[model samples]
Target: MYNALQSYTSYPFAHLVFGEGGDRKTLNFDHRINILQIQGLKVPNQKKKPQDYSEIEALSKALLTPITAYTDQFSRMDNSLFKIIGWDEAWAPLSSDIGEATMDSGIREGRSRNTSFALASQNPTDIKGELMNNIGNKFIFNLDDPVQIDRALEILKLEKNEKNRENMTLLGNGECFFRDIYGRVGRLQFDPLFQELMNVFSTTPPSEEDTEAIHQAIQAHTEVMV
Candidate 1:
């Protein structure tokens, strides 16, 4: 996403990424990246501590404030500004009642206000009920798990059948079963125009030692907090 927009000197739309840190390396398309931790909106390069109930509310409000502010400023469709607010590593936010409420309000009210929400999650089951209704487009990527495939189909509003199941699993890397806002369904492959984007979007893991070192660091931090 960042690579696609990097060429524009002046962005046509505003983009804000909401995540629990760790995107600093990959999200460097522009100098506007602000790593604001939920508490006091600190700009530090550290892994965030796990949130309890009170902290969850803080994080939820922090995310919802901008949406509310932007929506309130929209007097007319012509005068409204376009913005895309994305939530990466959305597990905790999706689980929170207040977070879900924030998203619910944003998804419902954002259309007229020219605000769009992008949520990235590995598990499709997390998207349920009213949240599922508001999602106009779905990109069903490769899934090795039957449970995830089932949920993906459910999100696609496709019938539970053998053919659909096979088709979903058949999707390779950068390929997806796309269902658009108009309910049109088709298969699509993501071909990056520039080779640099491959590096920007790659999920390839680091060496085992590097992984272990990072894990140990987080564990030590958690112990200190405890």
Candidate 2:
């Protein structure tokens, strides 16, 4: 998920934001990368954590602004903005009514605004049925749990034979079954070098020293370019 974000940020007029969940902190991307971090689903300097509904409402509003702006303009612009909203622990959010509503709105309305969503979660069952049904692409990694694998297969509409079941359970690390809305499906191996690069942007909390070093490096590089 982080790798996809890194690649998309390279595109022109791309705006990125992700929620901080679990132990993952806001990642420090390169100085040039304008990825925004929304902490605890609340704007900075708020006294209390926002209610679940409010959080989703705020997120939906943020996502729709660009779309509204572009459509209201007198002249259609060629260099239109694109927003990528990602959720790291996606299931937690989707479990709520507000979250599901927000996601459904985005999935339905995002394309007109040139916005997209990327979600990551451990268990497919934890995801809401509506959101799961709406997803156009899926990446199934190795799963030891039969229940989870079964749910994934059902969602993907793949036949559950002994051979297919065994393949899902035994896939190596970084190997996954990739399927798109266009009826394409295949097993893919992620490149080792690219995976290594993604590790640098991991959201897992880093030590204070490591965080400072990353900031300093980015600052130094930016200064050199200037």
Tens digits of per-residue lDDT, candidate 1, 1-226, equal: 7654353213212234333356454333233332323322211112433353353344444554564344333322342466666666555456654456667777887787576777777888877767878987888788878999988888887998989999988898899988899988889999999987986677887789978998999999999999
Model 2 — which ten-residue stretch has the worst lDDT? 70-79
lDDT of model 2 at position 126: 71
* Candidate number of the best TM-score: 1
Which pairs of residues collide in model 1? none
Segments in model 2 whose C-alpha atoms lie over 4 Å from true places: 1-79, 192-196, 201-226
TM-score of each model, in listed order: 0.60, 0.56
lDDT digits (tens) for residues 1-226 of candidate 2: 8886565443223333443346754333222233443333322122334453353444543443443333223112222666566666665455444455666776766677576767788987877577777788888889878899888787767898778888899888779888898967888897767766777766679899988999999999999999
- Candidate 1 regions exceeding 4 Å error are 1-79, 206-226
RMSD of each: 13.7, 12.0
lDDT value for model 1: 0.64
- In angstroms, the error of model 1 at 226 is 42
User: Which candidate wins on lDDT?
Assistant: 1
What lDDT is reached at residue 196 by model 2? 65
